[model samples]
Every structure is written in structure tokens, then in C-alpha cells.
Target: MSLETIIYIIFAGIIALLLALFQYFKKGKNRSKLDLFFSFLRFVTLFSVLLLIINPSFDQIELSIEKPSLVIAVDNSSSIKHLKQDDKTLGFVKSLKNNTELQEKFNVNIFTFGNQLREGDSIDFTDKQTNVHDAFKALSQIYKNTNAPTVLLTDGNQTFGNDYQFVTNSYKQPVYPIILGDTVSYTDLKIQQLNVNRYAYLKNEFPIETILVYNGSERVASTFVVYQGNQKVYSKPLNFSKQDNSKIIHFTLPANKVGVSAYRAEIKPIENEKNTINNIQNFAVEVINEKTNVAIVSDFPHPDLGALKKSIENNEQRSVSIVGVKEFVSKVNDFQLIILYQPNSKFKPVLENLKTLKKNYFTVIGTKTDLHFINNSNLGYRVDITNQKEDYQGVLNTNYSPFYIDDMGFESFPPLLSNYGGVQISQPIDVVLNKSVQNVTTNDPLLFTFEAEGRRQGVLLGENIWQWRAHSYLENQSFHEFDNFIGKFVQYLASNKKRSRLNIDFQSFYNGNSHVIIKAEVFDKNYVFDTREVLHITVKNKGSKTEKTFPLILKNNHYEVDLSGLEPAEYEFSLSTKNDKITKTGSFKILEYHVEQQFLNANAEKLQQLARNSSGTSYFINNANGIIKELLEDKRYVSVQKSSKNTIPLIDWKYLLGIIALSLSMEWFLRKYNGLI
Candidate 1:
């Protein structure tokens, strides 16, 4: 059966023949015929020993009847064709269309990738270049959750993303890579990346940002033009920084519109580069003019009211309203803040109703204040004055700071209050200002406050306005100080009124022939999509001039739009909504349609590595059938068998002596019958 077996047979025969010769030679010896016969028997015993050393065996093996999982991934990029129209690529694909073994073994899912990924039974490769990296990424995402082996069919031309690198990594299953069509030579230019802001200020400079490009050996300079609808807004010359690569470029273009502006950027074709179709980039920008509204409310009018109102009303953007404390109680929630002046005698009635306003209030206390409500109510902390002292005639005027508000030094100014007395602050008062004059007695508390649960209140103990408002050297600048204290507080609260920022996430596929549905999430304040706003979307190939608009209704503040008819290409989408025009812009490169291709190829390669790593041989698809059969039959294929024989000298020869005596008896009988002694 084997070379070793054949050699053993030949050697055994030759040894037997040599034994016969020795017998013949010994028979002719007259000195010791018996000894010669015994020597011949010894030679026979040696031949038997050699036969046993060869160690022959016959084995039967059982193989697995289960079939391995098979996956098919076909390249559905634009370069691949759909029909048999005398095209080489198409012909090759058609020839393999009816592969029954492939069909029976694989649970197939077909996919195409260009600017997006599309899945289907049949697809025409779009006229777009392929990005193999994106294709692999898409496949990885799809099959990452599965444990299936894959079979990938492609042309091996990756015009877009990375390729072949995935094969270098490990996979859970074997990847059977079957390359389709012969690689060909083609020269083309592609725009690698385009970057632009979806939002910009109206009548401001808009940055036209993009990356200049070349794919193969193409070097040329071209003029790039920016178009706003049918009008050409800007044009400039651009040079390819890299002959077979890409370089970044940024230029400012004037944006004079206040709304969504449809724009396209084009580069005149060079010798090797494609025309404006692949060189142009389309996009849209939402120019925003953020508007803000402000309102002011007050209690019993005070001298500081005029100053506060003037400070805010002076700004054209701010709207100031002066409402009585009584009127504020009715519409308090309408305004940002409620400013209350020194109350009359008792504050119980006002403080009782204060809890119903549902708004933060700033209360200022004057000389003649009511202690009944302050001492009894939960809204304002109680205050008491100890020393009955008079204010200095000319006090050293310094900065007047609130408890938590910042303090800026003020020069000497006329004293607003004469014969003023400092008052004792309560435990609720968080901080205290310094006493600039000795007249600041225990009778008057400069600043004190009461903080309610869920509501904030600021109470100024002493009201001396004429000095700080009129005589201060910063003349009209005290407004900044007053505004800062109130501004930060109100703005901070307003910001917290809404929840996290809005964001949407989703996935899509584009087969070169069919349009992939474009879907995304629409998140709003509190995830409540009740704005009824209209979301406008503009989609364009990354570097191609072809562009399309898709409008969706922001229902319940969430949106999902579909773009059903489109060819495979690299696309960038710009989104804008009516309320907030500057929305989200996303870029997605579609993958060629292929099923199981990536996984099978990845798995096959892994299986090959497994075999090699373990001192086994890798097999191809054509060889898998026979190789598996052979491996299953050979037990050595699973593991090496340790030799069971051991050599040693034995003293037990009783059985051999018995056999020798029986043979001698038979020989003697034969010799006696032949009439020989």
C-alpha cells in the first residue's frame, strides 16, 4: 500500500532467499551437519524479527456529514454590471449566477455600497467609485453579531475606503475570497473630503472649506466656483497639492442671506480629473440672527427703579416694563424677575400671597420697615437693630456689594442717608458687607435675605440710592454692576428650563441602483417633538455636483425622512429646521452590495491561519472537499500516536524450545522415511 510496506516485502523476500542460500551452503558441510542446520534456523529467526519491526496497521475512519455554513458577498459597486450585455464584468458575474453548490451551502444576503449601502437580489453597479474600507466597515457592523463564515466575490478594485487589511486580522469563521473579473487600468480624480459649517451668521463671512484631490497620477490646477442657486457668488483658482492624493483648502465666502442658502462648489475639469460632476460639492447653510427678549417687574416704585429701568431699556434689544407689586402678583410668572420695594406697615398679606406668585423675587428694605411680617413670615428672614446710632455727615463712600454679587470699588460720593444706623443681620443672611463709616450702627442691616424652598429671593436691607446712582464717579456705569448681578441669575435659571441638546442617530444602505431610505432621529427639549417645525434637508454626493432636497415634517419634535430613489455615491447631508435652522449635517459613504462576502473571506483566511499555526495545511474551496476527507481518515491528522514498542532481552524461551522440539521430531520422521540416519 505504501512505499514502506513495499520495501518491507522486498527486504523480507531477499532475507528469506539469503537464508535458503545459507541452508544450501551448510548442507554441503561434513564436519558438523547438525550445527549447520541449527545455524540456518537462527537465520530464519532473524528474518522474522525484521518483519515484526516494520509494524503494519489497517485503520477505518468516520467523517462528519454536516455541511459548513457558506456566505456570499458580491461587489455591488458602480463598477459591477447587472446583465449579460457582452461586458466582461457582467459576463463573469452571470456565469457564476447559477452556482447550485454555492447557493445550497450559503444563506445569502446581497448588498451594494457606494455613497450608502443597499441590499437586494439584483443590482446595477452605479457609475461611482468604490470605497472598500467603508464596505468592510459596513459588513463588519452587520456580521459582527453573527458567527457565520463568509464568501466574498469582488473585482479587488477598492476606489473608496480601505481593503485587504481586514483579511490580515483574525475572524471567527473562514472567509473564502473569490475575486471576480480581472483588475483593469482606469484614471480618475476624486474629491476625498469636504468640510463646511451648516450654520453661519447672516451678512457675515462664510467659510468655503474643502479638500482638493486626485486619486491616481493626476496633477493639475483648476478654477473653483461657488454658486448660490443660479448666481455665481465666488470663484478662485485651486491647485492639486498632491498628485495622487488630497490636500485641504479653506476660503471665506460672503454670506448675505438670513435663511437657508443652497450652494454648490465646482472645480473646472483638468486633463485627468473628472468633470464638475465628481469635482463639485453641494451644501446648504442656515444663517441665524439669534433674538433675545427681556422684561422687568417691580413692587412699590422706588428711587432705584428709574436707574434699573434705564439701564435695561437703553439697550434696543431689552424690553423693560414697570408693574406694581399688586399687578406683578397677577402676572408674576410672565416676567423673569419680580423686584419688590420697602413695604408699608405689615407684610403678612403680601408675604402670604407671595408664595402663590411662582416666581423669584428681589426685595429691598428702606428706613421705615415693617418687622411684623419679616419676623413672622417664611419668605423673608427676620431682622432686628440693636444700637441707636446716627450716620456720619460725610461718610467715606466705597463699593456697595451684594451678598453673592461681585464688588467694584467706588470713589467718594455724597452720602445718601444721614444719621443712618447699622442693623443686625439674621442667620439667613449668607454674607455681610464691610462698614465704611462708624455711623453704620447695629440699628441697620446693610444687606439681608430670605431663601425659600424651590424659590430664590434677595433682600437688600438699606436703600441709599442718591449717592450711588447720581454722585458716583462711574456716573452711568453702575448699570453694569447692577445688571451683572441680576443678569447671570436669570440667565442661568432660563438655561436650565430646557433639557439636553437635540441629537439624532440612525443607519442607511444604498445599492447603486436603488435609493436608500434616509432616516434619523429628531430630539428636542425634553424629547418632546411638539414644535411642528419643518426640517429641510439637502443631500449631495461628497464631491459630485448632483444634489437633491428632502423636506420632512418635524412631528412631535422628532423626524424620519426617506430618500428612496438614488444611485450609489458618497453623500453629505445638511439639515435645517424652521425654529432652529442650523441643524445637523452628516456624511455617509455607501458600500457596494455584497452578502456574506466579507464574512466568508474573513473566516476562510482565519481557518487558513488556524491550520498553519497548528502545523496543518490550508485548503482552498476547490480543495476543501478532498482535504477534509483525507484529514478525517488519517488519525495522525488529529494527533501523533506515540510508539508502543520497547526493546529488551528476555530469559523466557520455553515456548521456543517446545516449538523447536516439535519441528525436530517432524524432521526426524521425514529423514527416517527417506532412509537417511
Candidate 2:
């Protein structure tokens, strides 16, 4: 309390005392014991009222001891069970959590991770995949600003995601890894990796690549063979020792039949090999009979032409031919899709031929493009151009449903150059990317698609798209994402199929470890997407002669069904609507592969490196007592004394008001009873 508050309290007491004296010792008042009691009551009531009127506040201090957090992240993937360490892992975690010293010194938090991170001690060890990198990332975010040391318990075998060893650099807390599984090296022969294209042309030879590895000191000889169903198609003798332990085998197989074909590659394991499961691998490819031929017709050469050709031809089933407008006019009927690059008066003949034949074409407009010719071309759109050029960036439309396309971080791509203009479309169109200028998004289409008279047409309002491809590679170190985006657009244009009420999208082959999802879209009579329709799919296993039916759940703007429970075999499926008679049929194959069962031993070196990088120690599960001792001895993770101060009212208003009301009521009753009122 301040001096001003103290002075106010003194003055309030003096006034209360004076009022009590005046009430009892007035000029004609009698001096009696009852009068004294009444005076006392008046003094108490008056003093409380004055104190309440002042309402002074005082500072309150509180102290607490904050203990450092200790996070325990356990691996709950299937690989743990494959290595026969699930029970041992569970026992270790239970014993650690029950330790009295740990409970008293730190706040213990338990987590489990497989495909994702979850909080609990429920360790079923049934997860299909292991992602140690994601586990570390999630833990770093959860305890970013706190002193939380993590205890990672895993085999250090990640089936998917980025390398886990390098992820330790971003983590601020120390990570003590308790390695699981046997670290002993055995005489193991394994197929490290296999590479094959998804699609192959019928009657053509498709390339297959395999990498074989051996992990024994003694020299061994084996036979590497590939089988198509029950018949052996290829074989080679392989020799390996400690020095020469790896070999790359490349060969080609003929795709004589047009369907999904499954193949298995095996490296015969040497005698006394303990883990033979890693010796065989399965793969599949679809033999497609039809191929798409796309032509790029331009008046002059540009880098965009070469970029388009390379991106489109990344898939083995599609080919791109770059030709001038004069050469392309005569060969218009040879290609299914035509790409017109920066069309001007020279493209008049090409555009006329496309219009006459009702062929699909994609138009790309740039600064060099003649706006007057484009405006008079009657291509369902007109641009009122200006003499100025503008660099505009692209913003993706999340609602685009013509085909599934990811965002791919389009906002960071380099801007494209185009003439400043007001674009107007005369027909209904789907805008995939909108125009953005100077960080402000505009209601203009940068890339759009429309259909007219049974033909599809795509229009891009800018150029310099080659830079977009290069930027994508710089970001991801691969052109797969950008090329896939272009492939979807080209696939939509190359197909001459008429618009239908139902469209289905799926793959012809899937690995057993991957999810088999089929997506579908339904349209009403007027060609508008309908969300009220119900869909279902019936699948028939060709090998087992078994049938099953599943309902398709409605997702965002589409319906989908997951067939991940199906066994590895050839299967045919039919999709049908509930209210209408619309149906579509397709077939797919799932290859036999188990990624978790391929490991022979634990990855101890990477885990040790991870511990070293994070300033922690690595230990085996059987000898992990040193970790607890070290954690207890570490001085950096000690408890911190935290204090906080707050200003609070000295008197509670409720109790003060009660005291004042009780005194006033008692004094009034006493005066009335004595007939002194």
C-alpha cells in the first residue's frame, strides 16, 4: 500500500469514530449499556463501508518449480515385430515410465510413431510403414521452446520419407536412441531395388533394372532369375564377395499380351543364410496398345516448344513432334492433339484446318502473339490487347475438377510475360489458374479449358513456361511433379471421347504396400456436377473367383473407394450409380510385395550418427541402463524456479457487503426494540 492509501484509511477511521460518538453522546441522549452496544455496531458498519469505498489493492507473489520435460518416442511399426523385439520394447518402456527417480525429476511424456505420431503407450506394432524422419520433425515442433530431451526407441529402418540421419540437424534437443533388433551381420543376399516403367507398348520390349547386394565375407555364387507367373523368363549367374558385393542387372522383356503383367525377381540365397525373405521382389507393368501422338505447331522456334516436348514425352506411352506451321498443316490428321505456340497470321491455315477437322488444340499467348488475329479467330475467346507487357504470376484454383492436380506451389514460380489486356470468354470454362498482379489476386483466368461442339480446347494467357519447369526442378530436384501436371492437360485433350455423365479415374497396377483408390465424378443431365448421387463398386477377383461390393464415399467434388484390403491378384471392377443406370468397367493388378519384411538387421550406424549429431549417446536395448544414469547426471536439464506477481483486491466485495448489511440490520432492530428510533 502507498502512503496516499494509508492516509485515506486513517481519515476514514476518524470519521467513523466521530459518527459513532455523535450518535451515542448527543445533547439529550441517555448514557446506557444498550446505547454503547448500538454505538459499537454503528462504528463497525461505518468503518467497513468506508474501507469498501477506498477499495485498495495489494500485490501477491507466487512461486513454482518447473521441471524439464522428457519425451519417450517408441516405434510401433510392423518392422519391430518382424525383428522379434516387440515384447522387449514394451517391457523396457513400461519399466522406464515406472522409475521413481525419472518421475520425480522430469515430466515424462510417452509417444508412439509409425506412419504418423500418436501420444500413448498402446504398442500393437501393426503399422505397415516406418517414418523416423516424420517422428523427429513432429517432436521438434511439439517441444520447440522447451527443454525436452527425447528417447527414441526404434530399429532405425525407415521404409519411406526422407533420410532420418540428416533430420537430427534441425532438432534442438538431445536425442538418446535405444537401438532395437540384432546388429549382427549375417550371410544375406538381397535385391536392393527394382525399376520399371508403369506402361509398355504391346509387342515392344520394356527395360527392367535390378540391384543385387550381398552382406557376407566369404565368396559366394548365386543365380539371379526373373519369372513371369510360373515360367522363368531370364537368368544370370552372379558372383559376390566382401570387396565386390553389389551388381546392377539391366535387361528387357517383350510385352506380348495387352494387360496387367506381374513379374518376380529372385536372387538365390546361399547356404546357411538366415534371412531369405529379402532375396525376392515383385513388380508389375501394364501393356497398353494405344499411344497418344501430340504435335507442336509454331511459326518460330522457342524454348517453350522443347520444354513441352520433353515434359509430354516423359511417359513412355506419349510422343511429341515439334514442327513448323507450314509442315504441320499437311500432317494435321496424323496427330490427336495440336499445340499452337504464339499464334499469329501465319497460324491462320493451321487454325482453319483444326476448326474444319474439329480437332482439340491448346493455345499459348505471349507478348509476341498477334492480338488482332486472335480476336478475329473465333476461338470462343477475345482479348482486347494493349501495347504494354506485364509479368503475371499464377494462383491455383482449388476447385478445379476436370482432373486431379496438386497445388505444386505455383505462387513461387517465375512470372510469365504477356500483353496487358482484358480477356473475355464467350462459353463456359474451367479456370485452373487465376492471374495475380503485384501480390494481389485478380478475377482473371491465366490458364483455362473449355469444350465446344464435341471438341476440347485449352488456353494459356502467358508464355515463358519453360522457366516454370526449371523452377520446379530447382525446388524438388526432379521434374516429376511439373511433368505430371502437363500430362493431365495433354491426356484430357488427346482423347476424342464424347462427354458422358460418368467419368472414372484409376491406375492399371498397384503395389501391395500402396493404397488402391478409384475416383469417380457424376454429372446431371445438364452436365453440372451432382453431389446427391450415390455410387458403389463391385470387384471380382479373377484368380480366386470371389466377389465383393463396397460403397464409394463422397469426398470434395468427387466420390472415391479404397480397395486396399484386396489381396495381390488380378481383379476386375465395375462402378455404378445408385439412382441411374450409368456404369463403367476396368481391371487392375496388385503385385505381391512386403516392404517391412525385407530388412535383415537393424540400421545401427545411422542411429549412432543421429545420436552423435544431436549430442546424445546411442545404446543397445539390452544395455540401456547407462542412458538413465547419464540423463540423471546431466546438469543442463535441471528444474527451473519460476515466480509470478499479480495485483489483487485486498478485501472481497461479497464478504465486506455482508458485514455492512448485518451491522446495519442489528443496529436498526436494537433501536426499534428500545423505542429510540
Candidate 3:
């Protein structure tokens, strides 16, 4: 307590004593043992009340020891069971969790990871995919800014995410990896990867690329074959040794029939090969008879025109032709979709022709675009533009429902240049991307789509989209994602299908390991999205002649059904509404491919490198005991003693108020009993 508080307390006591004395011995009052007792009660009551008014506070100190965190991350992917190490992985984790000394020294937190990270020790080892990078990412967030040492139990054969070896630097904790699976090397021939387009034109040859790898020192000869059902369509002899262990095979196959076609690529395994499951791979492609032809009409040449053409034509079922405004007017009817690039006064004839013919077109606006011309053209939207140009980045509109599109890291893409303006859409539209300037998002649409009368139209309020394609390639080292996005946009505008009450979105083919989810949207008579309607899907396996039905659960703005439990085969499904007779039917094929079962042995080198980068050691399953001893001996992970101090006020103590009341009550009773009121 401070000196001021001490002085106040002393004065309070002196005043109480003086009052007690005056009450007991004033003038003619007689003094007795009872009087003394009454005086004592008054002194206590008055002094306590005064002390409460002062409300002096004292300091209290508390000490506590905070133990360091010990995270145990187990890989629960199917690769562990494929390698015959599930039981060993489980036993190691159980023993580690039950260790008394380690538990007492550190806070033990256990987690299991397959495609994602989950807390706890429930290990059934039935996960279909492995993503070690995501597991570390989650752990880094859970144990950030703490002394947490992680013990990773896995076979180090990741099949579903970014390379875990490259992401070790992101996590600051020490990672001791317990390597599972056999370390012995075996002569193996496997098909590493296969790439083919999702769709092919009927009667055309579709290209296929296959990468073959051998993992043995000795020379080996094998036959690579491509099969459709039970018949072999193509074959080649392949030779591999230590120096030439990899080969890239590229070929084309004729798509004679128009439907979902499943094919298998196999590299015949050598004799005595232990793991032959990886020698064969399955893929599928859909053949369609229709093709979308797009024409780009521009007054002058620009890189954006080329980029759009390449992206749209990436799908084998689409083709693009670029022409000048005058030339396009002659061949306007030849193409299904028209792309008007920065339309100005010279393109007035082309725009009028498109409107008259009721043809769908995509308008791309930029600095060269004439806003006055657009305002008078009656394209369902108008933009009030100024002389200044603005650089606007793209922000994805997650609620867009016209069709499904992935984010594809749009936030990191470079900005596009456009005239400074406010856009006003006169009709109902769905915005795929909104405008963001300097990181602040606006309500204006950057890329949007709308339907008028019986025709569909798409608009982009900016140019320089070529930069987006380039940036996408730089980030992912591929242009497939960017191309697929543009292809979907073109596909929507090229089709002449009218608006329907029931719409379903799904792919024609799916890999066995992928999630088979179908989304549906139902509309009422007035064409408004109806959420009260119940939806159901009836699926029939074409090969097995089995049928199953499932109810579609209502989501935020659509209905969804997960068909992941269905086995790999050709399926024909029909979606119907519960109250109405509206139904939509489609067929899709599921290829038989399990990425987790392709590994022959553990990826020991990469795991060792990961351990070295994180300042930890790598050990085999048999010698995993060393990890416990090492963690116990590590000096950096120790308990820290922390102290805290608090100042508590005297009035805050509830018992002081009780004591004051009791003393006052007792004094009043004594006075009343003695007839001294």
C-alpha cells in the first residue's frame, strides 16, 4: 500500500476510537463490562466502513509453469496399408502417446492427416489420398509461436498435393520423420503419368501422352500397350537401364464412336517385379459431334485477341477465327459466337447486325472502347465513361450460379486496363468477377453474363487479359486452368438451349479418387430460383445393371448430391423434382484409378531431406524409439516458469461487508437490551 493510503487508514482508526470513547463516557454515563463490549463493536463497525470508503488495494503474485507442446502427426492415407505398415504405424503412435515421462514433460497433441488434418488418434488408415504439405501447413498454424516439436509418422508417399519437401521451410518446428514401407530396391516399370483431353471430336484423332519410368539399375525390356475394353489398340517395345530409365510416349487414337470411352495404358512389368499394381493406368474421354466456332471481330490487331483464341481453342471441340469488322460482317453467320474487341464507331454495322440476327456475342471493353457507341447500341447495359483509364484487378464472385468456376488464384493476377466508369445493367445478370482497385472491392462487375430475349451475351469491362493467362502460367507452370475458365465462358454463349426450370451441372467423366458431386438448380414458373423444392437423383450402373436413388440436400442456393460411394463404371442418372414432373437426364463414366496405390516403396530420400531442412533426424520404423529419447534430450523444448501480479481492492472482498453488518447489528441489539437507546 502507498503512504497516502496508510495515513488515511490511521486517521479512520483514530476517529473511530474517539467516537467510541465519547459514546461510552460522555458526562454522566456509567462505565461497565457491557459498555466496553458495546464500544468495541462500534469501533469495528465505524472503522470498517471508513476503510471501505478508502478502498485500499494490495498486490498478489502468482507463479505457473507452461509446458512445451509436442505434436504427433500420423499419415492416415491408404498408402500406409498398401505398404503393409498400418499396424506398425499404429503401435508406434500408441506407445508414444502412453509414454509417461514425455507426457509429463510436454503437452502431447495428436493429429491424423490424409487429404486434410484432423485432431485425435483415431487411425483406421482408410484415407484415399495423402497430402503431407497440407498437414504441415495446419500444424504450423496450430503451434505457431510455441516450442512444438512434431513427430511425423508416414510412408512419405504423398499423392495429392504440392511436394512436401519444398514446404518444409514454411514450418519452423523440428520434424522427426518415422519412415514406413520397405527400403529394399526392386526392378520396377510403371506408367508415371498420362495426359489426354477430356473431350474429343467424333471421327477425329485425339492425342495422348504417357510418361514411363523404371526404378532399377539393371537393363530391362518391356512392352507398352494401350487397350480399349478387352482389345489392344496400340503397342510399342520399350528399353530402359540406369542411364535411360524414362521415356515419353506420345500417340493419337481415333474417336470413332460418340460417347464416353475408357482406355487403359499399361507398361508390362518385368519378371520378379514385386509391385505390379502401378504398371497399368486408366483414363477416359468423351466424344461429342458438335463443335463451337468463335469469331473475333476487331478493328486493329492486339495480343488480347490472340490470347482469347488460344484459350478458347484449347478444347479440341472449339475453334476460333479472327477477322476485321468489315470482314466479319460478311461471315457473321458462319460462327456460333462473336467476340467484339473494343468496339468503336467503325464496328457500328457489326453490332447492329448481331442485334438484328439475335446472335450471342462477348464484348470486351478497354481504353480503346467507345462508351457512347455502346450506350446507344442497346446491349442490355451501359457504362458512363470518363477520359481517364483505371487499372482494375479481378475478384471472384463466389455466389455466381450460372455455371461453376474455380478461383484459380485470380487475386494474384495482374490488373487489366479499362476506362473509368460506372456500369449499369438494365437486365438480370450474373457476375463471374467483380472489380477491385488498389485492394478495395467495388460493386461493379468486371466480367458478367446475361440473357436477352432468346440469346445469351457476356461482357468484360477490361482488356489486357493476355497478362492474366501469362501470370497463371507463371504461377502453375501450365495454362490448363486459365484455358478451362475461358472455354466454359465461351461454351455458355455458344449454346442455343433455352432457359429451363431444372438445370443440372456435372462432368462427363470422373476419376475414381475424385469426389462425384452433382449440383442442381430449380426455378419456379416465374424463373426465380426456388429453394423450397425437393430434388432426387436416380442413378443406374450401365455395366452392372444396378440402380440406386438418393435425395439431394439443399445447400445455400442450390441442391447437391454426393455419389462418391458409387463404384467405378458407366452410370446414367436422372434428376427429378419431388413436387413437379421436371426431370433432366445425363450419363457419365468413372475411370478406375487410385493414386495412393501407385508407390512401390517409401520416399525415403525426400523424407530425409525434409528432416535435414527442419533440423531433425530421420529413422526407420524399427528404430523409431530414438525419436523419443532425442526429444527428451533436446534442451530447446523445456517448460517455462511464468509469473503474474494482480492488485486487489479491500472493498472487493465480500466478507468485509458481512462483518460490518454483523457488528452494527450486534451494537444496536446491545444498546436496546440495556435501555440505552
> Mind giving the per-residue lDDT tens digits that candidate 1 earns over 493-595?
3232422233444333343323455443443454333346667788888767788998875432245576645544567888776675547787654533332
Query: What is the number of residue pairs that collide in model 2?
Result: 0
Clashes of each: 54, 0, 0
Model 2 lDDT tens row, 1-677: 89999999999999998999897878464577787788889999999989988988878899999999999999998888999988889989998899999999999999999889999889999777889998888888999889998999999999988898978678889999999987898889999999999899999999999999999899999999999989999999999999999999999999999988889999998999988888989998889999989999888889999999999999878999999988898888889999999999999999889989999999999988999999998888998777999999999986665666667889999999988866999999989999999978899999999889889999999999999999999988799999999998899888877767888988998897788999898878876677899999999999988999999998867788999878889899989998887999999988888888888778999999999999888999989878888999999899999999988775764788888999999999988988878
Better of 1 and 2 by TM-score: 2
lDDT by residue (tens digit), candidate 3, 212-320: 9999999999999999999999999999999999999999999999888989889998989988889999998899998888999998889999999999999878889
Alpha carbon lDDT of residue 651, candidate 1? 23
- Relative to the true structure, how large is the alpha-carbon lDDT of every model? 0.50, 0.90, 0.90
Q: Against the true structure, what is each candidate's TM-score?
A: 0.36, 0.83, 0.84
- After superposition, which runs of candidate 2 have C-alpha atoms over 4 Å from their true positions? 1-65, 299-307, 390-401, 407-417, 436-442, 466-479, 579-581, 642-677
TM-score of 2: 0.83
Query: Native-vs-model 3 lDDT?
Result: 0.90
Steric clash count of candidate 1: 54
